[model samples]
Target: MSEHAKLPQDLDPDRPSGARIYDFFLGGSSNFTSDRMLARRVLAVAPDMRRNAVANRACLHRVVRMCLAAGVRQFLDIGCGIPTIGTPHEVAQRLDPSARVVYVDNEPVAVTHGELVLAGNPNAAIVRADLRDTEEVLTADATRRLLDFDRPVAVLMFAVLHHISDRDDPAGTLRSYLAALAPGSFLALTHLTADHAPEAMRAVTELLLDSQHPGTPRSKAYLESLLDGLELLEPGVVPIAEWRPEHGDADLATAAPLGYAAVARKP
Candidate 1:
């Protein structure tokens, strides 16, 4: 069957989505032709796009493990694209069967695929909503059913904030979400940046300007400012691959310049 046939009827297979594009970058089969086409364009200028995606994903795995080790059992993965291998729920549930996860995303394809992937799993559910809509997401039936704001929850936002424009107030959106969580909750974030390769990143940014999800790569200084209230964890806001790599994974070090990552506590 064709990729379009596999997608939900309500989705436009021709329209490129950032979630699908990132899924393609991670070598997943959930993306459409349009998503691959846009990804190829990005790869042409930013040859390290796929590597950076993998690095960012690895960072997420480390964060989940750290959170679980810290005694956190609930996870709110905002803008969690199509569920792929080693996803928060899968990683957490593997370590602790009772761990609850609520995946949130506004993309129809992502939500549809997430539902299918999470089927029969009572401990996990997918919520379709924009991350910027703090109240809506926090109050969503699935979110409330699976996560308890009175207890600590890990808010995962990997490779999603760049799509949030400045006018939308990314910092404020984060604050609002963090405000809903109880103290001691964690925020694990990984964002694209132009600090390492300005010209190449600028070219990629221009290519995506007209796409469905235009990206805005910020500098380390600016991304750091977003975590003002939260107490940033050790090795603050370093490259995605550099954040507590398991066994000192030397290969990921090269991709470090592509993005910044950090896990902070809502103290």
Candidate 2:
């Protein structure tokens, strides 16, 4: 058996992986039973987030399409999960065949799966690197080769930044990327927040601390602070479902928004 096959199947097939759990939530088959167990517990508290996951993905697609429409064709998807569907490349390339994408994820499984999925797509590539290490990720061979630093690129991080702990200075790490982007580049992100969620969501956050990864849900104000250097776009920092919802999507104004989503330009 392969080394990967020999491992036990937990949240990540061996441990709880945010990417794997996200994949499971997105209706992908790449997750393990442990991931489902945790997901069930979390979902039970805030049922909106399950729908939020779907919305978050759609939000990502819209963000990519928006960037494409704005004449920005290069992309950098940080903390990109195991590409199950509606990926940055998939969304961007579908609209403009010349679109280029560089997906970065610290998870091995996510990178491996991304590579396999993009095997024949010359305009796209994946890098196994931490998002916090902006220099390493942006300077990697694939990134240097596929993306042009001089052009306006869209950096996307959907439903992933909450996984970064405050101690690691998630805000500070973000500044590095913002500084690296060329003029008029964009930064789009969605982050989980306990402020507007059910009280029980806090317990779920604690539960994650004991898992293989540590994540802390921030407040709307805190999440907004992360955008200090960027200029907010229209309908700034609203709930995931409320961010330019596609036609036919249910009205999210009355629903309990599980996380916040927004896009900004580095002017």
The lDDT of each candidate is 0.89, 0.81
Best by lDDT: 1
Clashes of each: 0, 0
Residue runs of model 1 more than 4 Å from their true location after superposition: 4-6
What would the TM-scores of all predictions be? 0.96, 0.93
lDDT by residue (tens digit), candidate 1, 1-267: 156356576787778889889999999988888888989999999988888899888889889999999999999999999889988999999999999999999888889989999999999999999898999999999988889899999999999999999999999999899888899999989998999999889998998875678999998899889998889999999988889888754487763387899889999
List CA RMSD, all candidates: 1.4, 2.7
lDDT, candidate 2, 15-54, per-residue tens? 6678777777788877777777777776787666577788
For candidate 2, the lDDT comes to 0.81
- Return the lDDT, model 2, position 221: 91
